[model samples]
Each structure stands twice: as C-alpha cells, then as structure tokens.
Target: MLLDLINIRKVRRAIVYFGLILAALFFQNTILAKVPILGVTAMVIPCFVVAAAFFEGGVWGCVFGLVLGIFYDLSLAGTSLLFTILLPIIGFASGSLVMFFLNRRPLSFFLVSAAALIITAFCQMFALLVFSQTKVLPLLITGALQVLWTLPLSFTAYYSCRKISGLDLSK
Candidate 1:
C-alpha cells in the first residue's frame, strides 16, 4: 500500500514536471526570444533547472536538466551540445547546494539561478570566443545582457516549482 502510494506520487510529479517543461519551452522559444533586451534573448531554461534542483534535490535536477538541455540544444541553431553538457552539471551543483547547505527559499533560488546563468553565459562566451573568433567585448556584452534579462524570471520558475513540490500527492 505504501509502495503504491509512493509510485503514484512519483507519477504525478513526473507529469507535473513534464507540463512545466513544455510550457517553459514554448515561452523560451516563442515569446521570450521575440522580445530581446539589449539585442539579447533570455535563456530561461537554466533558471528552470536551477529552481527545480533547488526544490527537488540533485537527482531530479540532473534528470530534468538533461531533458531540458536536449530541448535547448535543438531550439538554437548552429550551436553545439553546450546546454546538454552544462545544464546537468548546473542542476547537480544547484541540487547539491540544497542538499548540503542551502535552504529552499526564493533568496536561495535567486542566488543559485544567478550563479547558474553566469556560469552558462561564461561557457557560452568562451565557446564563441574560441570557436568563432568573435570579439571578446561583443560576446561579453551579449552574455551579460542575457544573464541580466533572464535573472528576473527566476522568481517565476522558483514559485512554480515550489508550488509543485509542495503539492500533497497523497491526497
């Protein structure tokens, strides 16, 4: 009886996460991309991963990060499998922070989300600089703009995941 209940909760959690992923993908690709801030579009996927990890733990974070990373890789043209590689690490680290030290709160979410975004932006900047011979200043500017633009939405992702995590699956 207990096992059955646990399994049911797992299923419900997965379904909720799937729905969030779909919504995030739609928002990121369609609406968010269309409205550029400083000519840079927001990459909101990392924030989602960070928030999920913040609430859900490292394993769940890593799993969803991989899933979201695939979507991210496919959505952007001419990019290597960067997010696929980076997001899982980001998720795992974020989750580990929660497991080891941090509490689950919006402030924690904000800090983790910002760190994740900055790391991703740095990785992206490094890739552009090394591979394409892009100028450092432009790459830095774009990456900074993207991080700044996306940071505000971390609250949304945080609250969404927080609400989902707080659900009473047994009921």
Candidate 2:
C-alpha cells in the first residue's frame, strides 16, 4: 500500500513537470509574444530543458528536451527540418552533461543556464551555417543576444521549479 502511494506521488510529480513544460511553451508562443520587451525573445524551451535536466537527471531531461524542441519547431510558420532535429540532440547533450556534473550548490543554476545557452547557440549557428548556407557572423551575433536573454530567465525558471516542486537541489 505504501509503495503504491509512493509510486502515485512520483507519477503526479512527473505529470506536473510535463504540464509546466507545456504551459511554458504555450505562454512563450502566445502571450509572451505580445509583450514588447521580453516577449518573443525569451527562450522558454531552453529554460524548461535546463529545469528538467536539473531536476530529472540526464535521460528524462533529454527526452523532455526533444519534446520541447520539436514543439518549438512545430510552432514556427515556415518549414524548418534542421531545427526539429538539431534541438533534440542539443537538449540531450546539455541535459546529460549537466546531470553528469550534478552538484548541490546554488551556483549550479547559473552554470547550467550558461551551458544551455552556449549549447543552444552553437547548435543554432551550425544549423544556419551548414544547412541554410547563411552568414555565420550574423547568426553568432543573434545567438549571443539570445543567450544573454536566456540566462536570467533560465535561472528564474529553475528557482520557481524548486519552489513549486519542493525539490531541494541546493546542497
């Protein structure tokens, strides 16, 4: 009986985690786009990926990252195959790396966020350069800007997740 209850609790947590991911994605796509400053610029999917990596470890984080990345690609208007494929790989690597170095310190949030941004930027740059045959310099600049915006947002999301889920990630 106790084991079943525990399993149920875990299942509930997993559901809540996935629910939050979906909600964040939706908000990022719709309502967030309306805001003048922060809207449309935020990298909510990457932030959620970091959160999943932090809380759920490597495998699950990678899976969630793939799902979030695919959703992101789908939300866009034009046809972009690379985005759908590359993002998942990036997410998987970032999540796995973060979990490998899993620490109990608060600084992990910043570190993980930074790593996520860097990985995302690199993936984007690669896609633009190789697949799209675009100018690397402009893509690099934009990727940097995106990283700057994503850093703090990732931290905030991680903090909120910890608060809501009551997961003591701090050491």
Candidate 3:
C-alpha cells in the first residue's frame, strides 16, 4: 500500500538523519572543536540542515534540523535554545523558498546556505550583545569569520545530504 511505503520511507529517512546527526555531534565535539579557528564548528552544524532542505523536502529538513539544533544547544555551556529553534525554521524556509523560486543548482544551494548562516550568526551575535557585555564589533567580526569558513563546507554538506537524503528535490 502507499501508506505502508510512505511509513517505511519515513523510517529509513529517520535512520539516516539520526546517523548524520550523531556523526556530526561526535566529530564536532571530538575533532572539529579542536580546530584552530573558533566558530567553525558552530557554522558547520547549520550547513547540514540547510543542505537537507536543499536535497529533501521541508519536513525532512525540519526534523533533522530540530534534532541537530537540540544537540548543538545542549553542547554549549549556556542552555540557549537558539539553534534548537532556528535551524528547523531555516530548513523549512530553505525548502519552501527553493520550491517557490529556484532550481536545484549550485547557486541555489549557496544562496540558501548563506542565508542560513546569516540568520543564525545574526541571531547569535545579537543575543550575545544584548544579553552580555560582548562588544558588537567583535561579535560581527566573529560571525564574518565563521561565514567565511562555512562557505566551502556548505557545498560538501549539500552533496552529502543529497546522498544521504536520496530525495532529489528537483522533482
């Protein structure tokens, strides 16, 4: 039955998404965290979510994003739920925007990834500035640095998600 097939597909997708999230978490904490550059680890997380949105549907992107967000938030010293809330919204928006006005192209993927990074970094910097005595200039500079690091990684993430999702959003 169609319903049975749908359910099975959902289960398979869940498994794949879970695996990706777990790997991301493990690598983020153990390896990527040690990278000489700060914020690189943080930026990579949302790239995966954005890639999911590009290759799969909004539903898939949102679910993976939510899970990644929760893990990302919990890892931080602060209990900020910004990642938990924002990535899913970004995923959903990415999928919806692509569906409405873009083809599945490198440019499209870049734009979506850039938008995700911008929004996430902006919210994070703004939150830091507002809630603490952090200087705006430093926050902005850090965000820019993170974005620079994330750009190439976004392409990798996009291709990786396309492979993992197996959804071909071009349809």
Candidate 4:
C-alpha cells in the first residue's frame, strides 16, 4: 500500500510538471510572442524550472531544465547548447539556494527567479559578444527590464510547483 501510494505521488508529480511545461511553452510561443510587451516576451519555462528546484531540489531541477531546454531549443532561436547548458545551471543555483539558505517562500521564489533570469541574460550577452559580431548593450538593457517584468510571476510558479509536488512549505 505504501509503495502504491508512493508510485501514485510520483505519477501525479510527473503529470503536473509536464502540464506546467506545456502551458508555459504554449503561452510563450503562441500568445506572448505575438503580442510583445515593449518588444520583449516573457520566458516562463525557466521560472517553472526554478520553482521545481526549490520544491524538489537539484536532481529534478536539472532533469526538467535539461529536457525542457532541449524541447524549447528545437524550435526557438540560437543553438540547443545554450538553453541546454544555461537552464540546468539556473536549476543548480536555485537548488543550492533552497537547500542551503532559503525556504519555499514567495520571497525566495522571486529572488531565485530573478537570479535565474539575470544569469540567463548574462550568458546570452556573453554568447552574443563572443559569437555574433553585433552590439550587445541594447540586448543587455532590454533583457534586464524583461527580467524585471517576469519576476512578479515567480510566486505563481512556486505555488504551482508546491501544489503539484505535494509539498507543504509551511513545514
């Protein structure tokens, strides 16, 4: 009975996560891209990964980030290597912060989400500077604002992950 319950929970968690990623991808590509806010669209996938890290820790974070990144990269711009490498790093950082110092609070969620976005921006900036012979300052400035625009929704991701993972953050 105990093993059955455990398996059920695992199955439920998988479904929840898969659903969340699907929604994020759908929202990002279909709706958000068409109607840009100041010519910037939100990337909710990383927020989902960060929330998963905070709730389930590094292993789940890494796996989710890796798989989602690959799926995302197969269609989006740039190479697969960027998202594949960068998102897992964000997950690792989110997991580290959660494991070492933070709880699954909204504040923690916001901070982790913001950090993930900033790191992603930096990585993009670095890639642009290295590979593309184009100006990166504009990208940096806009990316920072985009990060800010996306930060408030981290709480939504955090709560969603907690509900999906069947975790009680109050404990």
Candidate 5:
C-alpha cells in the first residue's frame, strides 16, 4: 500500500511537470510570439520558468528550468548550451529563495515573482555581457523591461498554481 502511494505521488509530480512544459511551449510559440507588440517584446518563457520555480521548489524547479531552457534554445535556433546552463541556474536560485521563504502570505507570492523576474533578467544581462556579441547596455535595458512585463504574469501563474495544487506555502 505504501509503495502504491509513492507511485501515485511520483505519477502526479510527473504529470504536473509535463503539463507545465507543454504549457510553456504553447505559450512561447503561440501566445507570446504572436502578440503584436509595436517595437518591444516580453520573454514569456522566462516568466514560465519563474512560475515553475516559485510554485515547485527543489529538484522539480531545476528540472523545469533545464527543460524549458532547452526548448527555448531549440525553438530560437540559437546556441542551446548557453541556455542549458543559464536557465537552470535561474530556476534553482529563484526556487531556492522561494523555498527559503515558503510563507503562504500574499506578499510572499509577490516577492517570489519579483525575485524570479529579477534573477532571469540578470542572467540574460550577464550572458550577453560575457558571451554574446550584442551590446551590453541594450541587453540590460531590454532585460529590465522584460522583467517588468513578466512579473505580473509570473505572480498570476504562481498564485493559480498554489490554489490549484492546494499547496500551503505559508508554512
């Protein structure tokens, strides 16, 4: 009976992981990309990664980040190795912070989302500064803008996941 319960729990976690992945890909390819922004665009996949980390901590958050990073890299046809390193770092950092402050207060949710966006933006900025040929200032500016745009979305996703999963983060 105990083994059956463990299996069921594992299955549930797997389902949630896959579901988040599909949702991330769909949002990236369809919803976020198709939005007719005049000149600027937001990085929805980062927001999704942030949401995953905020809601599901520990190894799950890292896994989500790694998977989503690979997907994002593949879809963009850019270097996959860079994102494979960056995304998981962003995920693990943000998720670790969330886990550290697992209080279920409304404020906690807001803080985590903000932290996720900030961390992701910083990662992008650092990567551009170190590896990419792009100008550092523009990358930093755009990353900052993207973080602002993504924070609200991350908050909504995190809150909704908390509600649906019945996971009390306030402890």
Candidate 6:
C-alpha cells in the first residue's frame, strides 16, 4: 500500500511537471518570442530545465529535458536536433551538480542558470557563426542581451519548482 501511494505521488508530480513544460513551451513560442529585446527573444526554456533539474535531481531533470527538447525541436525551424541534444545534457549536469555540490539557494540558481544560459547561447550562436558570415560582435551582443533578458524571468521557474518540492508527498 505504501509503495502504491509513493508511485501515485510520483506520477502526479510527473504530470504536473509535464504540464508546466507544455505551458512554458506555449508561452515561449507564442508570447515570449514575439517580445524581442534588442532583436533577440528570451530563451526561457533553459531556465525551466535548469530550475527543475536543480530542484528535482538528475533523473527527473534528464527526463524533463528530453521531453522539452523533443517538443522544442518540433516547434522550431531549421534547428532539427539542437535543443533535443543540448537541454538534456544541461538538465542532467545541472541536476547532478545540485545533488552533489551546490546548495538549494537563489544565488546558486543564478550562477548555475547563468552558466547554462551561456552554454546554450554559445551553441546557438556558434551554429550561425560557423555556417554564415555573422560577425562575432553582433552574436556576442545578442547572446548577452538574451541572457540578461531571460535571467530575471528565471525566478518564476525557481520559485515554482521550489514550491513543488515543498509539497508533502508523504501525505
């Protein structure tokens, strides 16, 4: 009976997380993308992944990352497997780092989220930089702008997941 209850709690939690990802996906593609800061959209997905992974642990982070990536890939154009490959790694790394090294705090989230955002922005710009003649200065500026724009909003993910983590599953 206790095992079944634990499984049910986990399933419910998974469902909630899945819904959160889908909602974020909708917000990202529809509302967030349209609002450009310095001609660059805020990539909120990384914030979601990093926050969840940080709060949930490595396995949950990986699973959410994979799901988010698959949907993200399907949503975007000309970027086939980019996020499908990257977010999971970021999620797993973020989760593992939190599990072993970092404490659950806002400062830690900021630092880790910033690092993840930097890597994501670099990978995105690298593809364009390599394939085309986009200048380094412009790409760097845009990436920095994106990170700045997205970082503030990342608190939403942090607080939300923190609340989720606080839930009493033992009940």
What lDDT does each candidate get? 0.88, 0.68, 0.80, 0.79, 0.68, 0.90
RMSD of 1: 3.5
lDDT of 6 by residue, 77-144 (tens): 87579899999999999999999999878899999999999999999998789999799999999999
Q: Taking the tens digit of each residue's C-alpha lDDT, what string does model 1 give over 1-171?
A: 777657887888999998998888998998998998768898888999998898789999999899999888988898689989999999999999999999786777888898999999999888669988998998888988998999987788888998899943345
Q: What is the lDDT, from 0 to 100, of the residue 130 in candidate 5?
A: 83
**Top candidate by lDDT:** 6
TM-scores, each model vs. reference:
0.91, 0.76, 0.87, 0.87, 0.76, 0.91
Number of colliding residue pairs in model 1: 0
Model 4 agreement with the true structure over 1-171: per-residue lDDT tens digits: 778557886777778787887877786789657765778766667898898898888888887788778878876875557888878878877887898899878877887788788887777678667888668778787788778767775667778888877877566
Model 4 TM-score, 2 decimals: 0.87
Please provide, for model 5 over 98-171, each residue's C-alpha lDDT reduced to its tens digit, 9 standing for 90 to 100.
Answer: 77757545577567666666666777677568877788778777777776666656655666556545776556
Residue 34's lDDT in candidate 4: 78
Q: Which parts of model 4 are misplaced by more than 4 Å?
A: 1-6
Predicted structure 5: lDDT: 0.68
Candidate 3 lDDT over residue span 1-171, tens digit each: 777657886788788878888877776677767774754444678888878877776887888899999998999897798989999998888877777788778888888788788888899888779889798888888888888777877776777787886666566
The top-ranked prediction according to TM-score is: 6
Which structure is stronger by lDDT: 2 or 4? 4
Candidate closer to the true structure by lDDT (higher is better), 5 or 6: 6
Stretches of candidate 2 off by over 4 Å are 1-6, 35-40, 79-100, 169-171
> Model 1: runs farther than 4 Å from truth?
1-6, 167-171
Worst 10 residues of 1 by lDDT: 162-171
